[model samples]
Target: MDPVIVVGAGPVGLTLSLALAAQGVPSVLLDEGPGTEEPRPARTVVLREDSADLMGRLGCRELDRVGLRWSGWRSIRRKQLVRNVPLSGGGGAEDDTALTGLLPAPLHVPQHELSAALRAAVDKAPLVQRVPLSRIDTLEQDPDGITVHTREPGSTWWRGSYLVGCDGARSTVRKLLDIRFPGRTAVERHAVAALRAELPWPDEAVLHRQPPWRTGGAEVSARPLPNGVWRLDWLLPPRGELVTPEALITRIRDTLAGWCGETPAYELLDTGVHTLHHRLARRWRKQRAFLAGDAAHLLGAVGTQGLDEGIRDAENLAWKLAHVWHHGPAEHLLDSYQAERRAAVAARLRAADQSLPILRGGGGLRTLVPGAARGHDTLLSDGHLGCGALGAPPSYSHSPLAPPHTEAHAAVGTPPGAPVADVTVTAPDGTTTRLRERLGQGHPLVVLVAPGTGVWDRRHWQTAGVMPRLTDAVAALPGSTELLVTESYPGASAHTVLLVRPDGHLVAAFGGVRPAELFTAARTALGGAPHEAREPVEPGDGESGGDGDGPDTGRGQGSRARVHADGSAGLH
Candidate 1:
């Protein structure tokens, strides 16, 4: 069996490859170029605290090294400061899940620097095979596997059990599969420039606009970069007008002059114009082929959320594929990929839509700017910092994969179906650590036993059959870990068990329930084989087999026992 094939070597593809590697799954990463070129014009991105935490877990810390931890943003009109707000709720008092100083607020990182960090990490990952200068021409998928047709000379075909299209907006895979991408593109074009200049501006990002808001006037944003440079994003009129290199520079100077008393000395580093778009794929998955990142959806650059959403997609899909490939889960488990991520993208898109209008000046409603800024604290705490909109955290309560929770669980901290709140957890040895730090190891399932819960025993569970069955199931799952805790949990009993999914979202919280009922819920969450096979095959263990390869390798081989003709061999 060929390795999982990941198309496009951008941040999304790189993240998925690394996530898969963490699960001991090998993957082939392909891109159009040598995969060393930096993104042009130095696109700056703003990552929310949650996104930063995810990257930190993925071992891509270099981004923080070359990025600025931006704390606040200010909006200016007619050379007057209208609204100024910090990105995070001071002291993180707005939300229970907020990790005060543990996590930084939204930070601005240049796109090229971020890509460089991810590329460096990819170079060190043993399981990721980087195939540079390779472009996917087309692909064909059958019930067994997928064969990728590339443009490589004399090597047109590459095979893999799964293919993910991380390719950007104009995705070949999505087009080949005939998936509909429905959304409108903004009539106006956005001009972005990286510059080294002496400007009279604060370190915080400044959104400046001229009067006559109804007509398309000068609306530009300037942000200080960590690398001692500045980035400016200018919005042009809807009418098409060709802007030359000198014209672009003059536009920048004039926009600055309108803000400050006079234009400051500046040296433009790079610049470009791009049209904004808002598009979402009709479907994210089709059999063994799937779409992620910009290939699945496209949002405006108003909030710089396109990259963050793409990374989240990679995190969500990687483990599901690993489970099916290594543990023989029913392929239907992949359905949750679409069910969960599509909802997230929808929420992000809505947030982006809401921000775009405000970003475009809101038809001269400048007075409301102060009011919006006042309410931004709640918006930022709700995890909408990425898109700069007042939004709520994603709710997976309706997710098919998330186990149903009770009323009591709903009233607890970090309600079921929401991302697990980051809390301090103490071990029996007196070692204290954050729950996220313990979960950073990337386990597919983590069953957290509350503090004061006595030594692990099946009899401890009030639900009899459930404990035994769940123990057996968890043991069979390759990347599952059972963590006994001595940390106090709000709204949880001593015997409460919290089942956390790979993406760190609470699926079920049960204090007391029948064993059969919980067991059924666990099976439903697993979604694959009814039960895992007990037989284990060591790669070096003496066993007659084809190719003399062990279960650890052997293309398409799983850790489970072989299915016999009598159907009595494997648990599935």
Candidate 2:
């Protein structure tokens, strides 16, 4: 099988390659620059709870240990505390009850650190073939495969089943595909500097805004990074003003003094000026070539939406690509990538656009009267601030991959397109575990049985006349599937069976045992044609059935599921 070609070796591309490798798919990673050991200049990047969870699952465990976790941001206007926006909609990070059963808190890690972690994981992945200093000079795609030629003379063209462009803002892949990026670049630029200083509030970000009468209309935000490093970003004056090193230092000192009551001694680590853009590609896909990360969308630097969104883009596309590669040609599965992600990126861009004015020090009446900006505040509260707080990620309810929602499934609270909550569940052996621990781990498709108030016995399921059919239906599917029988699923009714996709979105949710419906949904989701089922087998009847205690590691104890490092399952 041809390897999937990944352009750009940044966090997003590396993440995509790792995610695919987890699904037992091989990918060739390409980057134009030579690999560097020295960490890039510090830049603030907050990983949302989901992104953090994904990174952990993909083997970037060092992030949680090294990255600082923040609960929220404190907005101060002219030395007066305005609002303390919580990250998880609770009091603060210390409030465990408010965060109970939720994904981990948002992490404040520099982009370099994140890239380093992901790159490390990629280096360890045998399925990934990393090619450094290889620039794509041309891209050509045929009906079956994609070919990318590097700029290096005498170099052979790289071949892959599909190509994804994770290259940054000025993407050569998007340009080669002739996809139009439509959006305006903000005239207002911001100076971001990384400093080594001790901050009083080390766990929370602080945003300070001063009226034009004081500090020359300053708007700055300081977020604590790992160690004593703090990332400071402040809006730059319109073009005419010459910004010298001395002037920048004076501004930084004044801002720190205003926040800390005194200018604490600090060493400037790095500084750069960045122009924000709100651009998004008109198309995310053309044939076997696709766009992700900054290649696909470019939101203003208001909340670090681009980074998190790009990571999500990688996750969303990885599983589908794996499914299609392992199973067969599933056009709908691949097409849904753009359908779902494009809409999500568009929404985030809109939210970023709404929040840009305030971050740019144009809050106006909204700043003075907080109630006047209730709508904008709603966006912030809804996890639009910094990294998406513990709030819900984008929903794909409208996507073609999502089954049509009905009132019953809606009442269950696990909607067809909504992300499955990482609720804790009890195994039949009384072992407790989070739902996410098993859902998308080694299987692209998972059948979660929530026998609410019902016994965990297979006899009960057989008596209800759903076990045999369910088992047979799943057995007939193209790829590996996991059947998890838990004591109860929160927010779902008795005998509830949830068919989940690899990205944690529900393909379908049944309130009660409906084997035929589940079978149809599974086929539709996998983009497989109707196939005859083998003879019905009860639990423990064959190698397919489990020991009736919990989720059965299908086939055998040695068989790999969806995202295993062994690459035993789903690798064509």
Candidate 3:
């Protein structure tokens, strides 16, 4: 099989390549710039909890070591403390099923640091071929594969099964494909600066709002990065303001004085003026080429939504592409990439738009009305204020891959299309492990929860006439399908069967022992025919097989089943 072509070597592209490699899929990473260069002043990104989980899965733990973790944020108005919002309360509920405590806290790390860490992982991955300083001239896609032409000194070309554009806002791939990028750019610009200073409150981010009488009603945000570096952003005037270096320095010194009651010495590292944009491509996929990261959408820098969302785009798409490469063509599965990610990005943009007034120093109507402050406080407490700072990640309940919604499933808090809560479960061997740890192995996971206090053994499933059918069904699908019979699942009733995707999203949850329904749901979630038998190919195999055009005539790998002493069966 040919490698998947990944454009751009930024964090998003690097993540996509690493994810594909993790799934036993090969990829060619292309970037115009050499990967060795680091961005000056080092822009920081807020690595959300979900993205952090993805990084962990990709074996990129260096980021966590180099990032600062903060649990809450502070809001100040005119140097007066207004509110202290803990991110834990932003979108997390006080329930056992909540996903708050299962993952690492959000990390504040530099983008270059993230890229470097991912690049290091990529260097270790044998499946990825990194090509730097190769500017793409053009790309042509046929039904079988895509050919990318690069205009380096040697002018080389490469072939791949698919292409993904992780290039930034001025994405050459998106432009070459003629995809329209339509959205509004904010009239207000922000002057952002990075400095090395010791702040009093180094554990939490600070948002300061100045009244109109002081400094043109600017809003300043300060976030602590690793190594005592601070990222500061000052919302500049809407119009006619020159942000020269001297003026920006003066403004920074004045703001520091107000915060510390005196001007303190600090080293200015980098300064730049940025205009916010809320742009999305009309379509994310065109033929065999797809757009991701800033190439696909551009959100405001508020809450670092764009960066995290782009990483999600890579995660969501990589698994599908790998499935297709290993199995066969599932058009609906490939299409879900755009359907799910576009909807997620659009929802985030709407949330950001709704909170713009509050973030722009106006405080919205809360400042004018007597009782409106309560609503503002609720929004802040809920963590829906800007860019979904502490809000739960968007759901794919509307995606084609998601099972049809039902009230019974919703009542159990395991609705299809929602992320699977990371819960502790006991294996048949009496070993405890996180549910998330058993997933993301580039295959669908069918979790069979034993009813009541009785653990599910192979004898029990065989007596019920469900284990054989499920084992055969799972084995027939492409790739390795994991069938786990846990002793108990949180919030799940007795005898509940869950179909979880590789990315940890619930495909469907069956309340009772329904082998036929579970089989159909597994096939549907994997984008394979109910009875299709296709073999999973090893990466870099040069055999003739399905290029996602149609079904192949190869028989799938046989199941390797093992029965433990507890009579529990493990099938792969």
User: Which ten residues in a row are the worst by lDDT in model 3?
Assistant: 548-557
TM-score of each: 0.77, 0.83, 0.83
Tens-digit lDDT string for candidate 2 (286-325): 9999999999988645544568889999999998888878
lDDT of 3 by residue, 100-191 (tens): 53323467777777888898999999999999888898999899989999996638989999999998999999999999999877735788
lDDT of 1 by residue, 1-572 (tens): 56899999988999899888877788999887777865664477766666667777777876666776654576666556766656553222233334343223565788877778878888899999888888888789998889988886525688898999999999988998899999878735777788877666545666665533332256667777765577887777655686688877777777656555577777778898877788999999998999999999986544446777788789888878886787664666788889988987786777766655555444455545666643433343333244333333355777777654534242456677777766665432435556665543344433443443233332233232223333333343333444434334566654455666767777677653223334444555656433432333322322212222111111111112122434333322
User: Regarding lDDT, does 1 or 2 come out ahead?
Assistant: 2
- TM-score, prediction 3: 0.83
Q: In candidate 1, which residue ranges exceed 4 Å CA deviation?
A: 39-41, 87-104, 198-203, 209-218, 255-260, 354-384, 387-393, 407-410, 426-431, 438-479, 484-496, 512-521, 528-572
Q: Which candidate is the best by lDDT?
A: 3
User: CA shift at 434, candidate 1, in angstroms?
Assistant: 3.2
lDDT of 3: 0.70
The local lDDT score (0 to 100) that residue 124 gets in candidate 2 is 97
**Candidate 3 wrong stretches, greater than 4 Å:** 87-104, 211-213, 301-304, 357-366, 371-391, 405-410, 426-431, 450-479, 485-490, 528-572
lDDT of every model, 2 decimals:
0.64, 0.68, 0.70
